[model samples]
Target: MVKKWLCAVLVSWWCLCLWAAGAEHAGEKPLNWHENAFFGLHFDLHPNAGDTELGRETTAEHIREMLEKVKPDFVQYDCKGHPGYTGYPTKVGAPSPGIINDALKIWREVTREMGIPLSIHYSGVWDSRVLEEHPEWARMDPHGNRHPNYVSLLSPYPTERMIPQLLEVVREYDIDGMWIDGDCWAALPDWSPACQAEFTRRTGIAEIPKKAGDPHWEEWLAFHRTLFKEYVARYVAAVKAEKPSCLVTSNWSFTVRMPEAMDVPLDYISGDYDPSFGAERAMVEGRFIASRRVPWDLMTWSFLKTGDQPWTFKNAAHLSQEVSTVMAQGGAVFIYDTPQRSGRLNSWHMDVLAEVARFCRERQPWCHRTETVPQIAVLHSESTWYTRNDPLFNFGGANQPMEGALFALLESGWSVDLLNETALAERAGQYPVIVIPEVTRLPEAFRQAMAEYVEGGGRLLISGGEAAEMFGELAGITFA
Candidate 1:
């Protein structure tokens, strides 16, 4: 009973604030996302098999009102979610249940009429519906059982379903772009018969590594990463060929979570950040992405949430502080607003966004696609990270020692940028000091590179036990 009251009160308070800050936008239209757009908004209803009121309450007036007030440079609306169902009446894909009307059509029309660029939130790899419909396409676990959610990259899902759906949407609706989600982060190693045959074919290793510590584990892992990267590249190429102007990106593909050298042909790089307090996450992600030398944005969940608590909207001041961390490092800002099941804009939440927008715009002159003035250099090593990180993409909730190093630097008042092996290779000698944080496994090639840098008068700080032992050759004196 108390929980119900708290939820009701939070709703009332949110609505009140949104109503209070009902400011209108000027006559300026938003710039193209590929060109230069610092601020954006994303909404995904994530309709499942049980959704009963899809498109019931979404109207042009409500959408127009929200767009006019928020004035985002680009808007990513719901099309398909992890459940593998389209929100609208999709001819090429499965539409979610309880579609009273066309909600996606409404969003596209309203945004088009208002001149706001629109993109769809499309899920890749992690589609439950596809797994349910065709179990043969499912990934085979190491124990030879069918994995629950992901489809095999070697399967026909991409050609028959994923790519066709993407091409259909852009061909039919003419939306600006697509934001592919559930990719990379949801990827896992596949031990299917086809994958196994190919794995042996490519690596010349007859036996597959069951887990992380197997004899040829690194070779097995490297093979999987290459294949998954090919899967992403295939779809991106299809999208570009179909509609050359359409923007596309796979979430967390090149970010710190799966930090590789920027090898994929992404028009722009982006990831919607995790919902924990958000300020800390923005700082770490912003610093790494800034070093990638591309246009990127870090998203914030405008509401605070943890465990099973109700989603409560964060105040503008708190949101601003989070955005400041990203913008200061020259990263674009995107806010995710959880949509009501009824498909209507909650005016109260718009009020919070209005205030946050003002704060970001005020500091736009000094930030947005700017470079960090390079002070302290920290290596977020891809080779060292992938060496032992058994999981394909996500670290499975492990706290990063590299992040802790960055925090220590911040507390001691030094400007820092988190860089991958590729970025550091380009400008290694620019920074005075390079700190390698607690890396247990580093390639011999990188070790030689670091030794050369140190020999050339570069100051190297090797943190943690294994790193100290490995880099001890540079101490220039023997310890007792």
Candidate 2:
């Protein structure tokens, strides 16, 4: 009897070890330059109004069908401000009445079954209907207009209310990550009571700056950046406390300095989705930023063809070009879909996605493995855009100079392209030398890529106003 029991125990232990090994083999690491991509739907799932079957469960099943069909690596199921409207049945707090669909639960099941990580898209300073119910939680301007539906980081109450709910959903649904939005809506130094008090404490200044360009505006902006960094740090701590491995990221302003702020504890950072309006140089700078971290997540919009806007269909090719370039640089590419009012995929948009997915799959392995080799790389600085936006600068219409600069590179006899850090991993070796012009920020991934490039007998030329500030010491160059 003893010998039989010993043999059974040995068999059980062996099986357990085999199972653990299998799980590890199946699990994929966070994205790097060569293997990063995400198929995301920002407003993918909405609750059914009537006679409709587009609730969370149905949507999850639908998504699962597509995932099964496509078998892509990543998917971002965003909720925007409608978190409470459609998701697992919440007894504690509900966003709106008569809503019944657990979007998180459905995504959790589907992604987990398919071995994919699910990311929740949360708004940083915007709530759809929470402001109406809780007036104290609302963000107020100098005139006390209540700002309707917008909320700012100035108030800690919203974080107190919303972060817990977010944590609850993640714990219950076993989610893998979060994407924070609304961080760039307003400039920092808001006059909210909490913000004012904190500003006074930090700067020892009793009075608030009134105009947009006060002498203290730079200080005020720094305060806002500090405030967000602290809040993000706290939020990241909270997320890790529960899941221990969940990713936390913010949709940073188009240009953000990633390496300088490494102490700010975010798993990763992403830029906005509208590449059409943004500079391709910014896109290339973004690639440099993504190369700083393990999994570089970059957001790009899909074909947003509505009834009136038919030209958007052609833009799909542009999106494909940009997204494919980013993926090749080793960043996980997220393709966004702006849903129709009916909450179903538009037929034309669907066709575009089908082609995009098909093309990506054909070269999927290459995208995940290639590195960037470029002749010129441009820098993207939010401060430059902010300055350009100021009417006093005489830079013409806001965002015009920056817009013009983006197009001029390609037309000015350069093989212009935008590459993210992840993209750099797969193709960085291809270029013997590169140029970074007009950018003011350096992300860690780009920093590492440059270091490796230069160490391997590559020459880099960094020019422009902000470029000197970001890479002065690193590149051994001085712009006089």
Model 2 ranges off by over 4 Å: 1-61, 80-86, 186-188, 253-262, 275-285, 291-294, 305-319, 338-352, 377-480
Cα TM-score of candidate 1: 0.90
Give the 10-residue window scoring lowest on summed lDDT in candidate 2.
28-37
How high is the lDDT of residue 126 in model 1? 89
Clashing pairs in 1: 18-348
Give a tens-digit lDDT track for model 2, residues 1-480: 434533553464345435544544667333221123444444444322231333423465566555554444556664544332433454444443433454556667767655665777666655645665566666666665576556666664446656776688677876667777765443334578887788889999877776676767666656766766776677777876666556777666323332232556666657555545433534554454554544455666664444566646445567677676566555556666644433334556556666776677777666654554456544333444444343211223543433445456657865444344444444566765455556545566676777778788877666666766666667676767
lDDT for model 1, please: 0.81
Residues 1-480 of candidate 1 have per-residue lDDT tens digits of 434533554464345324323321232322234556778889998878898998889999888777667667778999889999888777767888878878888888877665566889999998888888888898888899997789899988899889999998897787878999999988888899999999999989998889877989888778888888999999989987766557889988888877787777887888877676689988888899888888788889888778989878888887898889999998889899978887987898887897888789888888988887778899898877786564787765333778889999999999999987767766878888888998877778778878888888888888887788888767653445
RMSD after CA superposition, every candidate: 8.6, 8.8
Each candidate structure's TM-score, on Cα atoms with residue i matched to residue i, is: 0.90, 0.70
List candidate 1 stretches off by more than 4 Å: 1-32, 396-399, 443-445, 477-480
TM-score of 2: 0.70
